[model samples]
Target chain A: MSTPFIITKASGESETFSLEKLRHSLLKSGASPETTEDIIEELERDFYSGMRSRTLYKKAFSLLRRRYKAQAARYQLKKAIMELGPSGYPFENFVGEIFKAQGYTVEVGVILQGHCVRHEVDVVAENETERILVECKYRNTPGFKCDVKIPLYVHSRFQDIEKEWRKLPGNHHKKIQGWVATNARFSGDAIQYGECVGLQLLGWDYPQSRSLRKWIDEDRLYPLTALTTLSKSEKQRLLEKDYILASELVSSPHCLEILNLTARRKHQIQNEVRQLCGNGD
Target chain B: MSTPFIITKASGESETFSLEKLRHSLLKSGASPETTEDIIEELERDFYSGMRSRTLYKKAFSLLRRRYKAQAARYQLKKAIMELGPSGYPFENFVGEIFKAQGYTVEVGVILQGHCVRHEVDVVAENETERILVECKYRNTPGFKCDVKIPLYVHSRFQDIEKEWRKLPGNHHKKIQGWVATNARFSGDAIQYGECVGLQLLGWDYPQSRSLRKWIDEDRLYPLTALTTLSKSEKQRLLEKDYILASELVSSPHCLEILNLTARRKHQIQNEVRQLCGNGD
Candidate 1:
């Protein structure tokens, strides 16, 4: 008679286990033929006598996901963006904010019209004497070549904007200036065209020097450098009003400079606080 | 006694074999003691009999050669370059060559001067009265941000160049009659700058539209067209003259285009060669 199955024990012992043997080992000592068949089928699929088969199953599972799902993929992307921080925001808007923060009176996302085309300019910054237009671009890939179409298009669009500016009331619009900021690189021909027409091709690096990186490095307006100088008590009141944020600002380089500039005054203030508190600590 | 090495050669059988057992098994075969030691060493290292060790040796040899030798590495790099073809070359140079091959008069490396920067244009192409400049950038990774320094520096450099060009002699000497190109991408500020200066920022798609891809695929030459234009007898004399590198002229796009343009009526000469048994096949 043939044995239906066999078992190799850990102690290096081997035994033939027939259906009769299985029934004998079971607690109830009785099983229906159908139940026996089902159990055997499951055992064949799930239980292997060797370790290698178990490893293979685990390896296969690791190589594949549970199933394809779009929602899960999007969640991962959103999580990644949120973690990358402020510089990761929409490229043009980020630069525009940087320019505004840099003490330039600015208008961002302005529309410009040209002779044959119309487009939007990203920023227009002005002072009492001069005006400048700024455009920002965010490019992800390499190999964008700027050539004829770009200059012709921008010139046409700028023309329309220039016409509208000419109609602006009084000298308020007289100093309006134009600029383009691109994250992508430009070709030589495009640069020459811009030169011929008096336009600027501020590729990726120029604006970083002028704006965004400047702000992150802590160039901000504060009390000492305020447009209007303040009295001692008024400055104290202002500091108290924003104490938590003011303290948090200490980590910035610009704030450190500000603190250094006011060292003598800060010492006096600290003495007063100490006198009131006594040796309480 | 010490534990003995064991191998179960038969089912339901358990046995232990020591060096003494091994000696007895081999003694009747008349192998020497040194031969037995060699056999034992091999068995120890490769206990799992079915596995082949040659693959490990081969991999080790390859690693040694690749790390220690320059020629092997260069050979691998060359093969990879050939495999990647046009895409493998710097995008700026590759795209410029494509335009040159297309019968356009092309200057591969050009320097453009702008009011605020100097830009190295990748290719300057002129056809009749039309002229354009191009820049190409190759990116291996996605989500690339343009560094602001280079473009701004270039802009500043361009300004100096332009200042010189504005002078009388330089004005005529340094006129770029066209656009700029970038393979990677431009930022919003760059686009605005382009507008301000009348430079065109042509995207990658624009150049690809001019059949640069198709020309590369078909290996078509302008010289073939020129050659077809030459009269039969004149074409024969020209081919016999050996004034040009026939192989390079046949293969190079620039040379081929020139030949096609110059050989406007030379197709009949090919028929004569065919009739004169020139076909070795």
Candidate 2:
């Protein structure tokens, strides 16, 4: 494009569309450099000033999908994570799996007694040296950022729980940590307060190299909802049965039997899951 | 009234109906003892097993309304306070008015910088020797309790603000306090945490003698929405214009001019406000 094209963002603010940013995202989705360049060139032909960023995203996503299903699914990972909730339970479970992947024994949705009161902690992960309490702030809306109130509340809750934990026998040496994880980004104040209070914050694109998105991509721990082969209802049923991660179905194919799918369709779903998770031979 | 009737409360818990409780409430609404007994007797005739307590309340309210409009309004104060919100702004303003009635100079919905971050406090009140920051938790739904998280978060926010307040040149001698006010009741844990951390909690029926209800009644600071003479839309318009209390209209009768209400209707509203607020000389 000769002149800068102003595109409306999800937040209703307009910014100049950058070819370099789009190219980087496409490449990050596992597309080849040539493929990313080709997609960007095609997209540039249709670019118009004042077009919505959502429309541009849909166009790019469809173009990517036509070339590779797994890459497209990976590209839409953030959106898929959002689809996990009208309720926050699924996201909490997803965070639990991430901790489990990192070799911690994780518990999802446990009510533990704090020093002052009982707190319903979203995820608790424990290893030999340390125990972590996670509070998940899930917002399904695009561009919704977790603000300072979240980290402030999470810090107090952790302090209460940590105090009680420190008093228990055989817990004298174990380090206690608080974490605030979200599928969305965190406001500047949220990060400042969280870090100042020694709380770990993991947002979709935060912490630079070790965000929630990075953690998911690191282990191919894609939520079941990210499988394009599965119907929405099919994925929801799997989620209801607590089959949250795609890797779970790959490891235990018997879980798919609950869906009562035809042999061919079941095989197709298994193939897609394995391919997407990089588990297929 | 021969066998005890089971009534479902708003929380969906069933309890045996108490005649003494009903009688006490009726008498408390400014009804004469004889009038209270008459209403109870009439209500007992229609009572059945497995009836909702809401039905009992409605029946008593309508029966009381037939005798006195002002008393009936007082009887429905809790529900009226709830009706002040689909948004919490009106409730916050009502809270400000309550603090004002207690002889404090108050600011509603003010954003003050905390030691760590800025906070949008619901109501800030100051007197010669004290400053109080209040967080109003308004729940439109009946039977919703303010859980421990509410107070835990409020206390942290208060601490952050208090830290900054302590550094202010003239605040050294002023007693800075944090308060959580709710239209709903607080969970036991919430009250415990709040009190443990020196935060004052005011709920609909909490602290026994000095609850939100008692405060409203102490000065006859009935919300404008509690005036039976005003329609919902009329009250809403007044609320939108920041005229939140019936006493607001009593002091500035000309505020009614914005509603374009008829002169007779205006006089009727003023008369009811005066009678309800005990300001009818």
Candidate 3:
């Protein structure tokens, strides 16, 4: 019967806070029904008009971390991804790994000759019948949406590259597609222009059923930064060394050697990584 | 003769510094041949391999300022244009004024409905036979160039607007054009793409015969910031009140009244403005 509390989003827009959305997200993070209800009750006491969504998220994350480490890590997947940057290279590699898991041969950064000029493409993925060029737009700040200008510029780049590609001996019969993948949402105009031009846009929660979040979760390809046991600097070190995915550490255990953690600490992190990745020891 | 004294450009490229180029620019700024020779000689003594061109420019500007006031202001036209912003609104207005000088009805910062969405266009100019949309890209930094992405994006926006414009009555007969104007230079790829797509590109010194600088000098449309008689804060105050052009003051002397200057001080600025604009008293 009362007016719903208004919350400020990262994009500086205000919206009425929905209890159902919060409850659904908590359950999605593997929180128990009782724990989810308890957290909801606790959060209700702190709810006020004009509260920032970021503050609300932090409060929930800290509360969850006290009860369950792995669940808390899972709950903060979006934030953890943002922590991978200040630079965009690591996010590009993370996107490449996602495509790699889908059985595509991926190159993270490569320079390709366009008809007019040379372009440094973010990710190039290839399969038997198709080649995909992806421009990964990474934003460390939450609520920064990729605008229409991004896809508009990207479409032109694709056109140039596609023209050069068709001239190669074996490329005429292959399908060449352009994709724009971002760690943020797409503006309505951006999505409209992208769809109109046939440039596949994959954002954080766009295309609802098969977004970046869904792909990461479905493939069990969590970023190394998702490990709660590792410190922020440790995650940055691994990212700098081109170790982006936690699943990467499973294959190349030697990557941990660079961190120089004690044997006990290393085992703890490895155990957390394995469990979070759904790989049973 | 000694490896041509490589000087670094603002865009981070190194090129052989040409004495002829320096002489040409100084002469273009209305410097006497004797003064130009003296300044060039002073600069040569300080020239070294790997020295920044910015340092070379400062040396010449300082030497010129000592000898001539108005000519030095003309010499630093490019820098004065850059001082117009940290924001791009004033630059947009300046660009609008350029089109207005050509007898086109110009609007700055107008929102137009596109085929799918709305766009906040920087400048819109309409003449009897032509309607042009200009995107003013202003960079406060010395060496930043408008790249291909800019024109590519502007082309898409223009396409959307042009489509909508065609649906309106009496628009089909007019030639619709998109322009990317910048106070700096354009990258080679940007020029190539813009030319390929029929988008007009106007940069600081592009097209050689009719660049932004040439247009300003030809029309005597120097920005108020170019007046050395006014202090930086006074120039900023004028810009804040939309007094972008020095000619604006000649038409409406009351704009200077806003600065609360002494009668003598006001006369000093008015005299300088008239001299720069060739409105000889």
Candidate 4:
């Protein structure tokens, strides 16, 4: 932060630790621009050369923690998202809810007959005008990207399902679409291929303004994994029971009894869920 | 044997059962040329119209079974190959042994570091001149084919591993190669893509002269699943214990005790293993 100096990265590699990079990371954590600038400038004056990136990251995290709880939580957003997976079913349900919020009737885990065989489609959201089949690609880490092959696979599959659909008596009336949604980003080729094939894609920050994050944020439909009150196993239990979103937890608080949580802990989780979803009731 | 007419297939679909097709199949089963022709000719006169494929299959199976038991076993090659899977590890180990028989040192389930991350390659065989990385795509049923996408995925993975190898201080000397071996056929595009990219592909009968079946046949290294003496659970146990090849079973016949077979059954299994591996002594 101070005078730009060299530091050791987590990859056991060396890089110049830039103030701009720190400021950008801070801004991403939801720090106010003015405060981010002030913190960076202050850290720079006090900092020494040859620092480890981990130490620098910790220092920034602590500063954000002291400044704002919400910003601190936002800093851990990637980790929170990652906690939702290993299986993408919960993410599929969450995406389905987002579509449901927008007035679409959603079905999760629909098995449709393809040309060659039957395929388990993640989400099917339909309204009077159209039906959309969505494939949810969930990765446990941010580093993994959905590549061209996924789009190719999905496009081929969509064609098969579409072929089978035509044989049904009244399937021709509604417009049908195929979509691939991922919490992670798509590789460059995936985006290009999907665009070329007219396959809709919605990744975390992809297509900029109307991405998966935007839909969830707008609807205030945060997944249970986003709650700090839930442990990894607790979150997993909730996800296993198909309680995907925080709003869903509020809707069926009775399900918490199966978790065998302490009375105090259950109350705390309920309070957090209500606060996160809204205080409308 | 009777003359064949239209027959219902395994898919419950109907097709004309041809004499030439039957002869080809018999020859593929390793039947003598004279007997194969005679069997087909004899069957043609006795067969009826509109027979189920299973009945025709059984008639041929009985004829071959009576003539040469070993050939009958070979005739069940597709089924035996299928029995090796659901998980391709046993098949992969068998492939490793095939390469081993050809005088290469083999490693199975080798986790190699790739450029982005690490990948667990099914088999890695090395000789003085070259090192080969093999990916075994095993399917439980013959209906599955290694499609164009598989080559694309394997090639991408190979490239990543190759990139990492280049970064290693002194890995340039050994010629590195990547291959994909499946117990089934490759889709047209898979072969096209593999040939175009110079990624070696060895499917059951792909690439003409050099196929997985050819290798196994040439080496006399049939998998344990080829033995009829073992039940499904017994074969599974053998596979789980990593006794992949019939030759391995012969070398360690004592391992057969855990299957809880009658003395006659154990003796029969041992005899088959010995015959299959050509260990007459």
Candidate 5:
């Protein structure tokens, strides 16, 4: 066993670095135990007593990069996601897909007429049971909670449309409800306000298994932005073609005919899609 | 019922297009039943008596794009996977991770000394029971089966190494075994040859519950390429840093600090990682 070393965390507080944790993370990444041990041994050999964890992490990562590029790639998924922007059309489509899965006829960027004004609804979903005017809020970065003010604004906006649209039996909606949805979670106050006002809220984990993430995974409706293999312009082209989810490849894989991809590349992706979402759950 | 349309099959045969299938697929993609009906109706209204299924698919996709870009994106997932090359290092890393979970100490792209010469091994794994040399074969395109020649070559290679290394007193590996793995399925003769020669084989679906995909899903060790949100370079950078699995992001999301991402973006990825792999099964 190596002596304990103090590591300055990103939080500015210092904590003792555990070689065991590093080894565990490495093993979790699929590195052979020998490779994991070798990397740890090397890291310990050069490690100083009072290094910042950031530097330690970087060194270990750098060492892993040099020894096994493939293993390193498997461990850095969260960082890879930062490359995909969630506050965009892709996420809105992702959210819309979930609502659709729950049996809602959903549309993004819909326009609904209010009593006193015209409101641009993020999503408007309709079904035999009820019609829901949804606010499709997308966030690129994580940790942003949909706050109370948003619910307050959307609540008023729904009322504005409800006040005017409710007058007519068959305008855009006969009788509709209101929902505020996000790929991120809602704040405590926002949830309170939404529940208090009888407004429905949906998010990644807002309602547990009934949340947005659950629906997407349940149907394997992963967004195009979630795929790590696409280039920016390639993703743009797919998006331009309205191909949002990786499962979309399920039906329209021929869409790749337009892109300059090798047959083997196409086959690999198709196989991956089949592997990921080819079969029905 | 709408009039049936003609669709040209790839086999050079024509078939009648089922509107119901289209409706089911669209609805499965999270399109509301009404929107699905409306789109089907419009496509039907513009229906030429003998339009190709391809033409009809294009028309429906175009309309869906115009009306619901989000929904369109959801339908385009297959094409997206081509953007990801599944027959490569990341995938090999993915495979290695699964084996690691199965209690193997693994190494990718290893070299072993043979009776006559030295051979490069795709993966070298060991535990208390067996020391196995593996050949990781990945194919980007579908329909390319691993033929008998693959296992033959791998068996020969393993036997060569075994002849020399078996006499060693605890080199990196003691007495060794041979296994050939591919992401694609094996040919009939290939499986026959592997079984006859006593060589182990693994693929996406080769051995049922012990298949590579089954193992990945059982552990929730999904490839980051499955995420639609990451860009090419971002995935590369993360891969370079050894971050390839979505689950890895759950523990050390601050790894994104090197990338120029917003706070919200980081948070979204963290949330997604948690959603994908947070609750351990």
Candidate 6:
């Protein structure tokens, strides 16, 4: 059979796999269909064969992924609830969502390493003069008997961030202060740790009633819509799992057959079932 | 119940969970007597009071994990069939493992942007003169037909790596070549892509007597003895799904339990069966 993408076969008569055909195949394989179209359009515009190699396509895909991720983050923030020790993403979302509700422009999950890769604070809120680094912890259980380990770790990471901020290129060196937020109440030791480190600690009892009037007036917080897309079911599901499963449930016929056969073979089936259910233990 | 290690209770007196007292509890939990001693020692090292911090312990655990991973990689290499495609890791393991195998010692997963992040090519073997970008692909199938996307993507990544390599600091403007080894063979397009990008393609070809000797002499291969400590039964169970799974299976009680269940379910007490007898999948 002729290859789907039409190109002049060695016999050399002007033939080509229509860009449209390439897109169709990518969609069939579960690729982001729109991505293929846009990429094809861009590639066609710059199609000098092998002049500029793979970096061009890599950049295109990277842009697409970043766009998708940013949009998802925004959508999630609007619908987030009082997330308890949530994983990295949800915790950041909660912090940004809270700030948005109170009218603050917030950026979540920015990488700041040692000077460049130091600490990755969950959320950073900026108004005009002041910048707030909000570290959010989403816990499954909400209790005051919090683990000292989590806060201490958070504190160490914060210290690293502070050290980096001290070296910020511009005026940011003076505008930033760190704050920690958690769904669960903090232990006294954690508060002591925060106090010792000169960081603000905001547990479940952060003064949510005041609405951060200073933040609003100074435009420290911008009013962004709370994430409205999160379904209650999705939120509940998020609360239940500590980790994300890399693979989606494969509902293909092959998977079904394997599951059926393995299920019948008790020992292997048990292992398979456990894996399917995410019980690595 | 008293904690496993010494805990100065709320009253603040020196208290200890003695070995003799803990022995009964350990036995009840099905731990062997020898295992109990190991457990107590570990618990003693890990235990702390006054709002215990687990970060240090976690760091220790993480260190152990890294050491175990390095050891595991060595073992897997030893068992690697000389002709197995790129060392027969799963399609996903291709790049990362090869990079690890070659000592790029950097994480490739961090740069991967795709749906199959679990299947990543993230290892780069780097030195002053040359850098080999190793992308591993482990497949259940034995042909290269179904597994071209990865090599294609990896070839694309290599192009990106080359572009980035030019921008690196100092006088180190070295070229980074790519190698892709998969348990499966390459599809026509994958091979074409590899060729287009100058990737060294390692496909599955059983080593002839002469080839084995060559591999041993080059010191480019891993020895099987150092790859794993799994029992024969465990190895058989893992190899059944994808022969590549032999490298992925971690020996633990859970894995053993799964194996036991699988065997019992496969043959309901028929004729006597050897524990490790099965054709490698």
**Candidate 6 ranges beyond 4 A from true positions:** A1-88, A206-231, A234-281, B1-281
Ranking by lDDT: 2, 3, 4, 5, 6, 1
Cα deviation at B265, candidate 5, in Å, is 53
How does model 4 score on DockQ? 0.05
The per-residue C-alpha lDDT of model 5 at residue B147 equals: 69
True contacts kept of 6: 0.00
User: Which of the numbered candidates is closest to the native, going by highest lDDT?
Assistant: 2
Model 3 regions lying over 4 Å from their true place: A1-67, A169-172, A257-266, A279-281, B1-67, B260-263, B279-281
Each predicted complex: what DockQ?
0.01, 0.37, 0.30, 0.05, 0.00, 0.01
Local accuracy of candidate 2 as per-residue lDDT tens digits, A1-281: 65678999999999999877887888888889988877777788888888999999789867776558877788999889988988999999999999999999999999998888788999999999989999998999998989888988888899888888888999998888999999999999998877777889999998988998888987899998998889999989988888899888879999999999999998888777877888431
Candidate 1, residues B57-161: lDDT per residue as tens digits? 333333333222322322232222222223323444445555665677877567765444455666777665455555444443444333322233234334444
lDDT by residue for model 2 (B158-196), tens: 988888889989889999999999999999999988877
TM-score for all predictions?
Answer: 0.32, 0.73, 0.74, 0.46, 0.36, 0.26
**What clash pairs does model 2 have?**
none
Candidate 1 ranges beyond 4 A from true positions: A1-84, A88-164, A167-173, A178-281, B1-89, B102-106, B112-116, B125-132, B137-176, B180-211, B214-281
Q: What is the lDDT of residue A190 in candidate 2?
A: 91
What are the per-residue Cα lDDT tens digits for candidate 6 across B209-243? Answer: 32322333233333222233445544444444333
Task: Return the top candidate by DockQ.
Answer: 2
In candidate 5, what are the lDDT values of residues B94-179, reduced to their tens digit?
Answer: 66776787789989878766654456777778887688787888777867788655765576566657767867767544556788
Candidate 5: residue B26 lDDT (0-100): 81
- Model 2 RMSD, rounded to 1 decimal: 16.2
* Every model: Cα RMSD to truth: 37.8, 16.2, 17.2, 19.8, 37.4, 33.5
Candidate 4 docking band: incorrect
Per-residue lDDT tens digits for candidate 5, residues A147-252, read 6557656775677678777677665545578888776789876777577667889876778857766666667666654554566777678777767766777577
Give a tens-digit lDDT track for model 3, residues A1-281: 04578899999999988878877888898888888887777777787778899888788766565458666666788998998899999999999999998899999899998887788899999999999999999999988999989998898789889989899999988999999999999999999988877999999998898999988877778899888889999999999899999877767889999988899998888877777887331
lDDT of 6: 0.46
Total clashing pairs for each candidate: 95, 0, 0, 8, 45, 54
Better of 2 and 4 by lDDT: 2
